[model samples]
Target: MKSALYLFLLLLALQVQGQHGSKLNAQQQEQKSPHSPEDQSQAEGENSPHIKTAPSNYDFAFRFYKHVREEVGNSNIFFSPLSISTAFAMLSLGARSNTLDQLHKGLAFNLTELEEQEIHEGFQRVLQLVNDPHREVQLSMGNALFIDDRLKLLQKFLDDVTNFYYSEAISSNFQNSPEAIKEINNYIETKTHSKIAGLLKSLDPETVMVLVNYIFFKGYWEKPFNNLSTRDDDFFLDAKNSVKVKMMHQSKPFNIHRDEKISCWVVEIPYKGNAVALFVLPDEGTMKQVEDALLKETVSNWMHSFTKRKIHLDLPKFSISGSYDVKSLFEKMGVTDVFSDHADLSGMAENALLKVSKAIHKAMVDVSENGTEAAAATVMEAVPMSAEFPPPPFIRFNRPILMIIVDKVTQSILFIGKIVNPAAEED
Candidate 1:
């Protein structure tokens, strides 16, 4: 399966704090509520036999990441592939023919042999598993559909989003209500724990619908970093440029692998639950080559090649953020139909000719002595927008590095970006 357009239009922000950093965002502290539709049987339809053994498809994600990285160039990049994929998957349920084909191929799904309902069920299963309240991880995902009250949307599409994707739908008169922007922004803030704001500065009067999705995560390292050991150090941005940064130090048994072929080091840092942050540090001046060789199979091989060993590690305690407008990026990915008049979103409404007009994405990541906290939000305006290995013997992340945040259960890449400079400001 291919990755979708705007699949990685991400905003990644990292915040740095000394021994202690800002507490988890407030939205995470609230009581957990089940967002699944009230109809239990409908929501829990027989688990797809395929979902249990099906591949999570990380190849599509890696390919998408490489493309966006090349486009953004030299800047710190971070985004949640799973979040973008989920949003597009929800949108695809209402897609038809060529439009649907583009989405499926772009997202890297081979559902030719699978029933359409089965695909939705697979996503539903994964969503529930990842968001299960019992899990130790704090992952909060919220999706909203803002539609102009004048249009009548199909009940099936609404039901699928709610039951399968756990999204909430809202109605608004974008053409007449000046407050529509504020309302949507408020929802984005609340969903992303206020990490993202102003996703929609203004709404087009002709817009018939807008789709928004946000994901927030906070988790302590299975083995927390010693805040007292954190100290200021030099982080090399290149051969000649460097910046002083607070580096978090830790010594423990960790999963690691060294790929001599690519001249890089891969390490896995486990979050409190099944989630983990995989770091790939290429030998000096080899970031591009390492990235060029990245793939789902390569990553899987590296992950399985890990041998636990006691190694000292120094990682900068820095926060970073990134944002992007990815219409052009999507076009590059061959996802053009949805943005042009040729778009076919007939599944959403009876006679409405709906196509995306704008797509905006924002993300933030904060790694401190305590653990790691990150959040991402994507807004597809209808007015519309479119949207490990280890080793650790004195390994210090003093240079540019690639990072991938993943959920092991689904093997989904929640966030992927390259950090060239810890002190670099958010875009």
Candidate 2:
């Protein structure tokens, strides 16, 4: 269960807001807090030779992705299911009875197969592994609970969140002070490296607690694209429409596979560590078919089929950002009780009638010849093949294509989205 939440946190790739240059030095990196008992236990679990993940875990992730895709429509879509689910998991920590059951079912957790304790433990282990300072992946997760000072929260709930999720607790005057809104937004901005702004516009007069989760990831490609080769090129939006884009060119060996069943080409580009960006390009008009057939099994098969091959790749340099209110999305997924008056969050406070009033998410990603510079925060050169050999197969992402940044070892998707028109001015 905890593994799922860790995967939930991995969905940090949603398009947030601003575009910033990632230029921080290693010395300037923020240090994690001292380890607790939870962290130690998580470490022990993570050191195992093989990582075990239940199939339902990926099913839950892909199901959530499908819902987001449907809601966002055909335009360019970017969201971190990990970010959304992490928030829900934290909320579920304080939920009880029917409310708890609804959250588990909505998030696609198999209640009969996994107990509650196991779920939380899985999350702890994943979090600890991802937050390891020694890892080369540039990733960080932050959670904050803004509560109305008038209502005293349960101490045990606060402690559990602190120990298990490493969330920061803050007290605020939601009803009296409008500054609470600013404070909350400011905190989110800092945590997300200013990628997301105005996360909380206002607060309800009776809002007992507001929970927020923010994750930022930045990594450079193991083999970077040559910046000099980047030039203006046409990106086909459709059969008759196209836009000029700054396409980055490279000719090198990449982990690629051709799926005849879906008529699509799948490729994996490794990052500095266990993370990688998987790009799926469908044949001409077969994008819809590929999307419809998307599943954990499909991705697993692609991974297994991947073989190092020489190819000339031309990918456009693009940056995308998006905002969403996922309350309706969750409602459509049959998670309505948590937002309605009947919400049972009594475990959070005594004699409470608590329910989530808002569910907001924002994400952004930028891909260039250098690598990636998103909300989190760059350079590499691909070695060209020998001139004596015949020209390698060229793969130009001239149209809409699916992209996912995943942790290769755990096979958890951190961010998933599509670049319909990389050069399109609008999101």
TM-score of each: 0.84, 0.85
Q: Residue 256 lDDT in model 2?
A: 92
Candidate 2: where is the Cα deviation over 4 Å? 1-54, 371-391
lDDT of 1 by residue, 18-112 (tens): 21232432233353334422223235443543242134446557767777887888878777776666777788878898988887777777776
Q: Which ten residues in a row have the lowest lDDT in candidate 1?
A: 372-381
Residue 324 of model 2 has an lDDT of 69
Candidate 1: where is the Cα deviation over 4 Å?
A: 1-57, 371-392
How many clashes show up per model?
Answer: 34, 15
Query: Candidate 2 lDDT, tens digit per residue, 190-293?
Result: 77777676656566556666777888887767666766677899999899999998987777789999999999998888876467889999999898899888
Looking at candidate 2, the ten consecutive residues that score lowest on lDDT are: 1-10
